[model samples]
Target: MSTTALSSSSTGSTGQPPPRRKAPRRPKPAPGTQRISPLRVIGLTVVWLFTAFNLLVLYWLIMAAFKTPLEIFREPLSLPATLFERGTPFRNFVYAWESAEFGTAFLNTVILVAVCSVVIVLVSAPAAYALSRLGVRGSGPMTAFIAIGMGVPFQTVIIPLFIAMSEIDLNNNLFGLALIYVALSLPFTVFLLTGFFRSLPDELEEAASIDGASATRTFWSIMLPLARGGLITALILNAIGLWNETLLAIVFLQENANFTLARALFTFYNAASYQSEYGGLLAGVAIIVLPMLVMYILLARRIITGLTLGAGK
Candidate 1:
C-alpha cells in the first residue's frame, strides 16, 4: 500500500522527476596541442598600452607645435592660446615654413616622392608580371635572386653610389635622387607585387590568351587594372619612405636650396639659437608628419587589405 502510494505521488505530483539530463561532453584537442595560458592576455594588454602611449605622444607633439617658444616651455601640457580664436592659432607653422625654408624643402620632397613612387610602381609592375606569370625556366631562381637584394643594407652601397653619381656629375641632381630611390625601392616592390600578381586568378590570364590577347596586352589591359589596390599601397609606401629619407638625401644633395624636408628639418633644428625656437621646431616636425598621417588615415583599409593580399600567397 505504501509502495503504491509512492508510485502515485511520483506520477501525479513530480511527473517522473522531469528526466535526468546528461552532462555536455568537452571536445578534446589533438594530441600535439598545448593548452592556452595567461601569457596571451598579458601580451595583448601590453600591446594596447604601447599603442595608446604612441597616440598620446603624437597628440602632444602636434599640440606642442602651436605654442610660442616661451609658452611651450612654460605650459607644455596645455593647448594653444589660439584655441579660442576663429581659425588655427598655429603661427609657428607659418614661421617654420618661411623662416626655416621648409616651403622650398617641401616642394623638393613632393617632386621627388611623386616621380620616384610612380616610376618604381610602373617599373616594378612589369618586372613582377614577368617574374610571377611567365612559365620560363629559371624564373623562380631569378625571383629568389631579386628578393635577396632586400637584405642588403643601404650603408654598404652609399659610398659606391655617391662615387658613381659624382663621377657622372649627377650627385646633387633631384633626378639623380629620384633614380636612386627607384632603384633602391625595386627589390621590395618587385617582391611584393609579384606575390600580389600571383594571388590573382590565373583563369583570367588564360581567358585573355584564349581570346587572342597578346601577353603584353593582357597584362596592361586586364592585370594592371585589377592590381590597383596593391599598386596604390606600393605607391603610398614608396612615397612615405622617400619623403622622410634623410641619409641618402643629405649625402647626394649638395645645395641648401635642394634640401628635402628631412634635410631642411635637420638644419632647422640645429640652427635654433634659443629655447623659444622649440615651437617652430615642433611645427616643422608636424609638417613632415601630418601629410603621411592624413594619407594613412584615409587609405588605411586599402593599405591593410592590399598588403594582406600580397602576403597571403
Candidate 2:
C-alpha cells in the first residue's frame, strides 16, 4: 500500500471518537406550579372556615366555663376578665354541681356508657362474625337490613321505644338507658365489624380447622385476637356515642333524680322563673365534653390503626 493510504487506514482504526450523549430532557415544573382550580380553592376555604367556627365555639365554651355570670353577659366573646377571681368561678361550679345533683348524674353516665359499650361489643361482634364468615342463609339481606337502620332517624322510633320501655318498667332507670344505647349503636358497630372481619384472611381459620379445632374455638381463639384493633375501635366509638347521648336519656329518664349530665344541663333554663344561668350552663357543657376529649386523646392511636387497617383492605 502507499504510505499515505496506510496512514489513513491506521488513523481510521485508532482515532478517538466523541462520547455518546443523551438528549437533554426538559426540566419538570415544580409540584406547586400547576394552578389550583378555583372550585377546589373555594372548597378548601369553606372547610377551613367551618373548622375555625367550630373551634371558636369550643374555645368560647371553655373560656365561659371559668367566667362569672356578670363577665359572661358583659363580654360574651371576650376572655374572662379575671378567671382566677375568688368565689365567682368556684362558687358557680359548686352551686351548679349541687343544684344539678351532678354526683349522681356523673355516676349514672359512667355506668350507662360502660354497660352499653360492653353490650354493643358483645352483640355486634358475633353478628358481624356470622355475617362475614358463616355461610348462613339470608346473610346478605340481613346485613343490608341492619345497615338500613342507620338511615332511619331516631325521632321516628323515640315514642315507640318510650312506650315499650314503660311497658317493661325500665323507664327512668340506668339499665334502661344502657339497653337503648346498645340498640342505637348496634347498626354502625355491626357494619364496621363486618367489614373488619371480612378483611381478615381465612387462612388462619382454615389452619385451625385442619388442626381439629371447632368453629367456636377458631373464632374465639384465633379470629378474635387478630381483630383486636377493630374491637378497640368499636368500643371507643360506642363509648363516645353512649356517653354523649341525650335525647333518649332525657325521654326515658323523666324524674329529676334519674337525670344524666346532659339532662341536668337543661335544668339551668327555667322559663317559669326565667332563670337561665349561662355561666353555669357553659361550665356544665365543658365538663360533659372533657371526658370525650380525654378519651379521644388516649385511644387516638388504636382508632387510627383500626380505621387504616380496615380501609387498606
lDDT, candidate 2, 1-313, per-residue tens = 8997777776675574445699999998665455876666887899999999988888888888788777877887897767575645465577667777788888878877887898899899989999989878999999999999999999899999989988999998878877888888899999889989999998988899899999889889989988888998999988887778788877888787778888776664452125656676666777789889888989898998898887777
- Off-target runs (Cα >4 Å) in candidate 2 are 1-35, 271-273
lDDT by residue (165-236, candidate 1, tens digit) is: 989989988888888999999999999999889988999999999999999999999999989889999998
TM-score of 1: 0.85
At residue 18, give the lDDT of candidate 2.
42
TM-score of each candidate structure, all chains considered together: 0.85, 0.84
Find the candidate with the highest lDDT and give its number: 1
Question: For residue 118, what is the lDDT in candidate 2?
Answer: 85
